[model samples]
Target: MSNSIYDFRASRLNGEEEQLEVYRGKVLLIVNTASECGFTPQYAGLETLYRNLGVRGLVVLGFPCNQFGAQEPGDAAAIGQFCQANFGVSFPMFAKIDVNGDNAHPLYNYLKHEAAGLLGTEAIKWNFTKFLVDRNGQVVERYAPATKPEELTPAIEALL
Candidate 1:
């Protein structure tokens, strides 16, 4: 099993394979996103955090998922275009992938295992669920889907 996110590779929005190792020393806010969800506007907040704190080693990684309510039906190209057009998202975004069940992405599996959700359950409850990682690549905390991205500034700052 991979010991950390740095050990895994994911397909970027453009279909390029990227090693998470590139972010080895960065604090990451890994989020599972969906375009049609109620929390979709959090994209703006996430971007604000990324733009504001990215210089300090914060990297917000967005991974779109459609597992809940079929919210993200768009393919990679559409998802990318939608994010850029709607929210001006500039942070790195990956191809859509399942965040739960058998087809779950390996990186997400690792995150859920390392940091279970509320009630200690590992299954992701919804889109926009966020996971924070320290610069060392260890999972630090898991935030529910309802937790606003700005609300995480303190925790993220602590890691930076």
Candidate 2:
């Protein structure tokens, strides 16, 4: 894949076109989320991290997915409402996108290629999978669906 994750673009929940370039120079945590998944509550911790680290150059990006167990079956509006009401999430959230299969988003494709999970496996097995990127736009780590956002504090601190 290419070195520039900024080459990709995706639509925001509000239908606004967002270039990955907008996150340039910021360390990012990209997550595939599901509203009803077991890991769904991570949104709270993610939001906390965002609130704490955002001023220090951290940007958390959430992408709601329904590909697994149909947990995130809601449309963009519903998903946004759920996150706002339950988690009080203030991070940037994008429209639903498959993180695996033939139609995976291009940004996810690059992330998987850059930092594959255990044994260098590129597939995202379930929701809440995370890809951490450095300020230079390079994917630095891939966390499993079970990895909680708080567990990544050390790694994120190191990058900061």
Candidate 3:
């Protein structure tokens, strides 16, 4: 596996295979999301961040994960609709993925390795856990599930 975040690829919500290299040079806010979790509301804040700072080179990538409480039970289409209709999330949304265990996605494994959670634990505790990637595709920080998306603006701006 490569060291950069751009070395991985994930399937978009629309069923398209997207090479992370496409986001190279752009600040990335990657999150493992869920529809029914308490933190699901963060989607709105995330969308806000994306819409407001996107022109400044920020992009939020949402990866729906069912590994946590089965909160994100919908298929790709349903997840897409719920996000768009509810939070008006316009940023990139990827297909459902496992954020832990043997099936964890390669991108997520890299993120965890680069920025472990509280106490240096690599496992994702729950949905909405976020990973920030700099313009050079380096994992810079990891945010707990409770951290609101709006709180990331300062860091994101700094990278932008």
Candidate with top lDDT is: 1
**C-alpha lDDT of residue 20 in model 2:** 93
Lowest lDDT 10-mer window, candidate 2?
1-10
Q: How do the residues 47-115 of candidate 3 rate in per-residue lDDT, one tens digit apiece?
A: 999999999999999999999888999999999999999999999999999989999999988999999
What does candidate 1's lDDT look like per residue over 104-160, in tens digits? 999999999999987889999999999999999999999999999999999999999
- State in Å the error of residue 139, model 3: 0.4
Give TM per candidate. 0.98, 0.97, 0.98
CA deviation > 4 Å runs, candidate 3: none
Local accuracy of candidate 2 as per-residue lDDT tens digits, 1-160 = 6777788899999989999999999999999998999888999999999999899999999998888999999999999999999999999999999888899988888888888888878888899998899998888888988888999999998898
TM-score of model number 1: 0.98
Mark the 10 consecutive residues where model 3 has the least summed lDDT. Answer: 1-10
What lDDT score belongs to each candidate, Candidate 1 first?
A: 0.96, 0.91, 0.95
Q: Clashes in model 3: which pairs?
A: none
Residue 128 error, candidate 1, Å = 0.3
- Cα RMSD of predicted structure 1: 0.6
Ranking by lDDT: 1, 3, 2
